[model samples]
Target: MVPRRIICCTDFSYNSEPARELAVDYAKAFGARLTLVHVIDSSLFPTYVDWLGDEIDQILARTKEAAETKLQEIANKCGDLSDIKTCCEIGSPAEKIVGVANDEAADLIVVGTHGHTGVKHLVMGSIARSVLRTAHRPVLIVEASPLG
Candidate 1:
């Protein structure tokens, strides 16, 4: 059966637009609801330097605000084809993606992968991989064409 509800995860990166487009296409095709989620990675906070305190808090606050604005823009780009909801959360990307997908009762999850392999993949673990293993629903991963 075609997905009735889709959760599209976006980082607002240029490469991610293809995945968002794919999500928009699926949503329009299946007459499904769309939820565009952008997670503000909390790992940016200084872990060892406790003295940064207030400065760190301010950075986190501003980052989340920017994320909301970007998420709205991404939602708008999803076009006037389907019902689209925008969500911004502060946490780990994979955890938040999975949580939102389940909370929204999504039939499918859409994400973009950097296509990193071998050592690069190990050094920076893939969020899509984590979400794929953790999510209860199916996930669609979009990668850019090599011709570019």
Candidate 2:
């Protein structure tokens, strides 16, 4: 089915670039509205530090701003799409992405994978894998091109 809305997730990493591009292509092909999303990993901060609340907030605010700016830059490069949206959220990347997809009633979820495996995969969980497993809607995963 032709999607009415598509959600593309990015960490602003090289691994996710292909997926972003593919998402833009799909959105244009289907005349769908594309929503580009970035999630600020809440795990990076210390939640138990009460004294750091203000500091954390300041950091998070800056991070969110930067993420939004980057998303806008990417959206600007998506050619002539009429309906492109940018979302910056704070939480687990995979969870937030799935939540956004559900909340937006997105017809499709597009995400990129770092193709991590072995110990690295064990240590740093795969967001794309989690989204694929948990998302209620259809998901399209783009694997990063292998490094030379």
Candidate 3:
């Protein structure tokens, strides 16, 4: 089946760079429309009520701006594909990514995994794994680091 649409979720981490590249290549190969998505995990931030008196708004604004810039850079590096789109969302990363994929009717979802094990894995659950488990569409999980 032809993948007419693809959703790529990125955290802009060094580990995720390869997944971004892979998504671009896949999009090119399949002649698919690509949507580059970045989700801001708001849970990491203090509650809105708690931050009302602080610089939280400013921080959020700055972070969004930076994410947009980085998303543009990623799109540019992916190639001159007119069909490419960029989106910045706020919520749980994995949930937002899946939500976008569903909302956009993506045929495939691409994500990067650090492949952490042991205590590390327990602490930081695998977003890629969660997506793979819950996504209705096909999911591609790229290991952040290369394997020997």
Candidate 4:
């Protein structure tokens, strides 16, 4: 089915650029509402340190702000596309991506893979793999470029 709403999730890594480009192409081609999502993995925060509530709040706020700025830049670059939106949240990347897809009722989800394999894949895990497994709708995975 041609998607009326598309969710494109990126980690702001070079690996995700291809996915973003493909999302733009699909969105433009289908005249879909494109929602760009970036989740700041809260798990990345240091667990060993005891952080004060205010400090944690400040850090999350700063991170969210930075992510919003980047998302806006990406949205601006794709200004020709229709009904573009940006979402920045703090949570597990895979779960948050899926949540956004459900919330947006996205017909399609586009994400980039790090192209990791074997031990590396096992060690680093794969957000794309997780999303592919859990998402109720169609998912398009763009492999990382070889130049990287």
The true-structure Cα RMSD of candidate 2 reads: 1.4
lDDT by residue (1-148, candidate 4, tens digit) is 9999999998898888999999999999999999999999998886556757578878889989999999999999995886899999898999999999999999999998877889877644478889999999999988886674
Candidate 3 C-alpha lDDT tens digits along 1-148: 7788999988888778777888888888888999999988888888757737657768788998999999988888876676899999887888889999999999999898776788876554477878888899999888766450
Candidate 3 vs candidate 4, TM-score winner: 4
Write the number of the candidate with greater lDDT, choosing between 1 and 2: 2
Q: What is each predicted model's overall lDDT from 0 to 1?
A: 0.84, 0.90, 0.85, 0.90
The reply for model 3, stretches above 4 Å from the true place, is 48-51, 146-148
**What does candidate 1's lDDT look like per residue over 1-148, in tens digits?**
7999999888877667788889999999999999999988788667678888788778888888888888887787677765889888988999999999989999999998766679866643478889999997899988744431
Predicted candidate 3: what Cα RMSD to the true structure?
A: 2.2
- Report how far off residue 2 is in candidate 2 (Å): 1.3
Clashing pairs in 1: none
Off by over 4 Å in 2: 123-125
Clashing pairs in 2: none
Residue pairs in clash, model 4: none
